[model samples]
Target chain A: MAASRERIREVVDRYVGLVASGTAAEIVDLYAEGATVEDPVGSDVLKTRESITAFYSALEGLEQRTRLLAVRIAGGEAAFHFEVQTVADGVTYTLAPFDVMTFDDDGRITSMRAYWGDDDMTIG
Target chain B: MAASRERIREVVDRYVGLVASGTAAEIVDLYAEGATVEDPVGSDVLKTRESITAFYSALEGLEQRTRLLAVRIAGGEAAFHFEVQTVADGVTYTLAPFDVMTFDDDGRITSMRAYWGDDDMTIG
Candidate 1:
């Protein structure tokens, strides 16, 4: 198995599209109905499509900026490390550690796990 | 495939042993020879057993503290997201984002990619 930057780009593109265009559905499209999202410590595990949608709906005005730090693929799997920045509730939350992403054959992100500090740490 | 904390604990245990015991070889035992580790953004790709060992060797006296945030195993793979703290040259670095780890059937980490800020963001 091998991973191509182009493939990863497509995923990133979709995410960017979600932010630049401010389309909530775009984020929904990238995930399966049963997709899961977790904070840096995996404390807040959100499951199902509805919660996922609600999750994005609440972030209506907080734009997201993603930096493609690195992408690599092998053995039929790939991982993307990135930095995410956004403003929520007048607070800038910059989780700039890394998030490991894995996708299925269809290029849909099966899991999005962030690596950063606990809830006490916040940055712009 | 499913993941259990007990299983994940073993891996973390080995890593912790490497740190608490200060035995370089213990760390080596946790990774495959060809294993690759990237900084939070996937930069600084280090491959091979020797380099991995050398990588840790350089941090001889530095101490590392790991907090087990969350872990899930569905399929044959698992992801554990947690925070890492260490001090270097009187500076404390706390990469509290996360790293996604995949393991082989033998339980050795196949890949470890950290998620945190780029080199510019350093915290204790």
Candidate 2:
């Protein structure tokens, strides 16, 4: 169990690094084949790997970076708080998001739910 | 700074304990006199201790319990994921909420924002 917890933590750290480096293709590889993502809690779940890959591809063009503020892992799941900085239309924006993710026995993310709303974004 | 992080972590633990014990009044006391809360990200902010107290009072009649899933603290802020179990009208409901909170220098919670939606609830 302890080893599994450590692996989940490593996966989370790798996620941050990959996002900061703009390696979108590599990011998708960290998830299991049928992983689902529901960003912003109330939104529709994105289930297809193709759609998930495309969702990450959108990040490739943006000058974006992520800084992890906090992380918690337990019961084969992890939750983290992070701040994302991005530039769009020459304006810098900061977004704070809290994400809860569950992993399978193989340490691949099976499901991810991000919690954030427009109110959590700030223009810099 | 480290001491402040420890204090914040302690406060978060206290919050979980108080909620589990059904001590709603004392839970509100963990906040500063004028702390603000937005339990659901898109909801209107609740300001003033009286209003906050009343909001918590609503918890008193429910058979509720909280189990901490994860906690992270940094930069005078903390975010945690937890499961809330409550019985209403003889039905058991489970809620999963991710909360981000900022604390004042005095170790009191200055602001709390909970991220959850209707989709996050499960009835048993």
Candidate 3:
């Protein structure tokens, strides 16, 4: 059985909320074991749970806020556009990446690929 | 060589424009010879040009307009949110689907997967 749309939407909501203030461990908990993550699309994929956790750990100390701009869920998969505003070293940077994610029947993310490039970021 | 960002943006713009007014053949021309299309993600993938063309032909006479809400291009692929509004029998239907497309070096689309379900559509 595929994940329900309501379940997928709940995950997305939780994901954005966690990205805003939750710990890296909390964020990684949303994924199933052995899930793969490739943020920024061209980057190397992180296939291990440890590596995936390490990747999200980068945001642990950052002052960031996230918002889900839009999302469409279908066929146990979701593609969403979300904004992440981070403040680091007194400079504010905004990046909105569109992520494509596949989920298991239990609603845990199985794989995620985010689409964004240098041109997609803004600095102020 | 990978397709340049400018070329990818151009294709996206042209695609939105074409979808609003062009024939199915014109829209299918943006794809490579053996490209595949899986609209609404869960639907059967259209593997051949004829099938893809037939799929788009459904929009042929409908009074439809399209707008590109947002788009991100990375690693020779693009994920975009776009709105398509169609008027039929005095009713308007609005659907915004997030599309992920991989491009060939020549800037032609190689594969397209759209994400949207019934909940994503609105009728007015």
Candidate 4:
């Protein structure tokens, strides 16, 4: 049985909300046990839950916020384009990346890969 | 100066329109002289305009159609998610892919990389 488009969208919305207000552990809870993530397309894949959690944990106190610009859900997959704004060293930075996420039968993210480059970063 | 968001979107919309109604040569005209393309993220890059034109030409007479699901433009870049429906060998197929396209200073597509996999294809 395939996941409904509404369910996939709800999961993506919940993910954006969690990234805004939840802890790294809480965010990891939304993924399946053996999920993987590859951010920035050509980068090394984060293969285990621990690594993925650590990656999120590093952003714990960065005052990061995301705005969903668009989202498309088909079958058990959802892809979205969004803007991430963060502040570091007294400078504000905006990163816009498109992420394609695949979900399991239980609506947990099984894999995620973000496509962006250094050129996509904007500093203000 | 960066290209306006409206310009980037117009280029993308024009590209879609050309793909739907124009020839492969016309589609290639939307790209810059030395633009590159990598369909399906990890594939070998199509380095020259000729190869890229050939790639599009192969789709000729296939009755390919694309429905834009969402598009996001920032700075000189635009990313879109769309569904491509086609029929081959008496089987109808659907492919939903997210493509990130970068534009040059003149609003011509400089690079395009599509994100998708075998799992994302459906046949009926």
Listed for each candidate, the true contacts retained, as a fraction, are 0.00, 0.02, 0.86, 0.04
In model 3, state the lDDT of residue B58.
89
lDDT of 1: 0.60
Docking class of 2: incorrect
lDDT of 1 by residue, B39-109 (tens): 54436688878877887776567777666655434333444455556866877776544456666666777
Least accurate 10 contiguous residues by lDDT in model 2 chain A? A69-78
Ranking by DockQ: 3, 4, 1, 2
Two-way TM-score contest, 1 vs 4, winner? 4
Residues A24-82 of candidate 2: C-alpha lDDT, one tens digit per residue:
67998999988998776657799998888988888888888889876656556777778
DockQ values of all predictions: 0.07, 0.05, 0.89, 0.10
Clashing pairs in 3: none
Task: Point out where model 1 deviates above 4 Å.
Answer: A1-99, A102-124, B1-5, B88-91, B119-124
Residue A107, model 3: Cα distance from true site in angstroms: 0.4
lDDT: which candidate is best?
A: 3
Provide the lDDT at B61 for model 3.
Answer: 87
Candidate 2, chain A: TM-score? 0.93
Q: Model 2: how many Å of interface RMSD?
A: 11.6
Tens-place lDDT digits, model 3, residues B1-124? 9999899999999998888899999999999999999998999999999999999998898899999999999988999999999998999899999999999999999999999998888999
Off by over 4 Å in 3: none
- Candidate 2, superposed: residue stretches over 4 Å from native: A1-3, B1-124
User: Cα RMSDs of all predictions?
Assistant: 9.4, 13.9, 1.0, 8.6
lDDT of 4 at B104: 81
